[model samples]
Target: MTWSIVARDPETGAIGIAVASRFFAVGARVPFIAPGTGAVATQALINPLYGPRGLALLRGGAGAAEVVHALVADDSGRDHRQVQVMDARGRFAAHTGTDCVDWCGAIADDLCGLAGNMLAGPQVLEETARAFRENAALPFPRRLLVAMAAGEAAGGDKRGKQSAGLVIHGTEDWPDLDIRVDDHPEPIAELARLERVSRERWVHFKRYLATGADPVGITDRARIDSEIAAAVAAAQAQDAGEPAAGKAPAA
Candidate 1:
């Protein structure tokens, strides 16, 4: 009933997950992250405990494989659940319970992990992982979405799509970007639309939010507006394939 991708961005060290399923609010139950620690996804008769418990183990310095083992070994429903883990070091691990529905399996390596159950076929996972590996130049969130969209096109969730989600952690316990399309008729497309809409203000606005280094971030209205305006213009220019105002294009 669900499929997901958990990964670490080699360039920025950010961790993220993109998932879709023929179920309501798949976002609420499947994805979890511990920022600088790692990311986890639990599905197919999901053990919600896997999300928090898995991250706790990773935060405790367990390897990806060990985290997956500890999660499954202690659960009586191990034969009916599916889980995936990606550690800060790029190690990834996955598990598909023997009792999961047809077409259940997983793929993992240093780059990413893909897992699903009650899927159309193995191609769903294959195409998803392929897109993630190939779309290296996309913005991190977009790259994750592109990969999930590709999986959808390959006949995602044999039952059909209803919900999808994208979550990412930059360097904090909280997420940098978290988007969910709960109960949408076309969740993946809706997620894509939301992702694009986020750049309009949310992305830039979040930059002003307090961070660990400066808990009392900028508060001056004049400064916030001017800086946000400048960031927006620079982003828009970059989106248009033009160099940002007063800045040189990348070499």
Candidate 2:
């Protein structure tokens, strides 16, 4: 019903997952990440437990392959499950249940995994991996978006499109770069646009935090607004066409 990719940016030590599907709110159900541990994508009869369990295994010092092994080995329904995982150290692993609907498969490599069930064809996973690899020069969010676009182009979930989401954790704050198109006509594209905007917002926050430069008194609400506006504009200007490229910053 869905496909997703979970990865860790080695340069910045940032962990994130991007997912899209014909299923509504696929992001809410599929992608999971622990700030300093790893990322997980659980689909195909969607065992919500995989999200927490995978994180726990990684937190306990298990590598991606080991964590996935533990999850599949413990579940009697292994043949009906699909999961992808990337540990903090950048090890990657994935599985597709044999019982999954037709055209199901997954690919894992270099701290990244792409998995899908009931896809239009096996090409979905292949295209996704290709997009990710080809976009190595892009920022994390752009790379994620490109992979998602590739999947969609290669005949996405046989069920069609509905919702999309992106999550990056282990940042300095909660809700760190989390964006979702809960139910939209063009969710993947919308998610990409939201991610771009989120990048601008992060820049504003960084400027505020690093410079202690506020437009007004600490107590003035209006001054706070202006300072934020200015910072956002600056960030946008810097990002637009300047070739934004860097791993997500460490938590």
Candidate 3:
């Protein structure tokens, strides 16, 4: 009872997954991503091993198709599972077991894998991939959200919706954005609200965290707070179509 998208942003090298399901806490189990490595979404009967094992294989230089093949080859329960992998090279591969519920299948392109089980119909996956492709100019996280939204609009989990999640990994080992709405009547909308809230502060604050390139990230608390405030103000101004403070409006 789930549908998901796994994609890699070629320009930014960011990888992410967006998923929604009638099942509770789908976020905790379905989507897995490692920065600079790859992403996986496992559903249907839901073999949790596909997530980490797929990432390890990708890290070991396995292609997306190779990883999917290896995973299904070793699993005795492959026929009940649905999984998708997107490798670091922007290649995608997916598998939907023959025994998975009706309306279950997958679609893949160069940069994304779309899969779902017990969906409204094939249009759900089709619209998801189309939206992601059409919204190439959007920021990675927003692109994921919009894509999932389109799928939901087309008719989400045939059983109905209970939870949704969005996860993105950038250059850091940690996720750039990880938001979930577990057990909500309108889970996707709640997830979208959380995304907006995250942008207001958490996203900007994360830039100050130490990473591979910067071990001692901005230790000055005052400076960090000032920068966050400035970012928020600038965003608000931009949203209103007004010039940011200290910047002249174009004539």
Candidate 4:
């Protein structure tokens, strides 16, 4: 019914989940994240409690493997549940119930977690993990989309795609990026388009939103506009393979 990738950005310490499924609004139910804790994606015959409950455990200092173990051990539906977790320290764990549908399972390493049920084949997850490792240079959010697209190309959701979502958390309580497609003919492509649109302003503007360290964040509209303009200009330059104004190209 779904496939997802949970990952931590090595450079920025951001954590994220990318999910696509035949299920309606899969994003609303799976993929739970808390910036200071970790991330969880619970599916298969999912027990939604795992999302919040698992995050609580991570916040309380449990590791990924420990959280997975605790969540499964206490559930009567354990035999049908599929879950994967990544802790703040980057430890990872996955569980696929004994009774999950064929082609359903999970894989995890410190760098990422890939899990799915009702998938076209194991390659759905394999290709996702491969792209994730190979595309480390992509911006964190775009890297997740690229990795998930590789999974879809490998034959995602045996039933076909209906919805897709990407949720990312950096060093803040709220998401750095969150976008979902509840229903779409080509969900992943639609998701990509939405992400592109968000960059025009939301991506640049979010930097001014209130954060833990700054309760009243960047109230000056003129300064905010200036930063957004500069950010837009820099992004445009980077996209054109030119250095940002007054900035040197990467060596």
- The digit string of per-residue lDDT tens for model 2 on 68-172 reads 899999899999999988887787888788899988888777757788898999888888877778777676777787877888888888888899888886554
Candidates 1 and 2 compared: the better one by TM-score is 1
| TM-score of every prediction relative to native | 0.93, 0.83, 0.93, 0.94
Sort the candidates on TM-score, descending order. Answer: 4, 1, 3, 2
**What is candidate 4's lDDT per residue for 1-251, written digit by digit as tens?**
99999998888888899999999999888999989679999999989999999999999999999999999999999999999999988878999999988799888765799999999999999888887787777788778888888888889999998999999999998899999999999888888878878888999999999999998888899999998999998887776752111111121
- TM-score for model 1? 0.93
**Superposition error at 144 for model 4 (Å):** 0.6
Local accuracy by lDDT, each model: 0.87, 0.78, 0.86, 0.87
Candidate 3 — worst ten consecutive residues by lDDT sum? 242-251
* Model 4 error, position 110 (Å): 3.3
Candidate 3 C-alpha lDDT tens digits along 1-251: 99999888768888889999999899999998878988888999999889889989999999989999999999999999999888878888888999999899999877688999999999999888888887776667777787888888889899998999888899888888888888999887788778878879998999999999999887899999999999998866664742121111121
The local distance difference test score of model 3 is 0.86
The order of the candidates by lDDT, greatest first, is 4, 1, 3, 2
RMSD of 1: 5.0
Clashing pairs in 2: 170-251
Model 4 CA lDDT for position 103: 90
User: What is the overall TM-score of model 3 with all chains considered together?
Assistant: 0.93
- Which sections of candidate 2 miss by over 4 Å? 172-175, 200-203, 206-230, 242-251
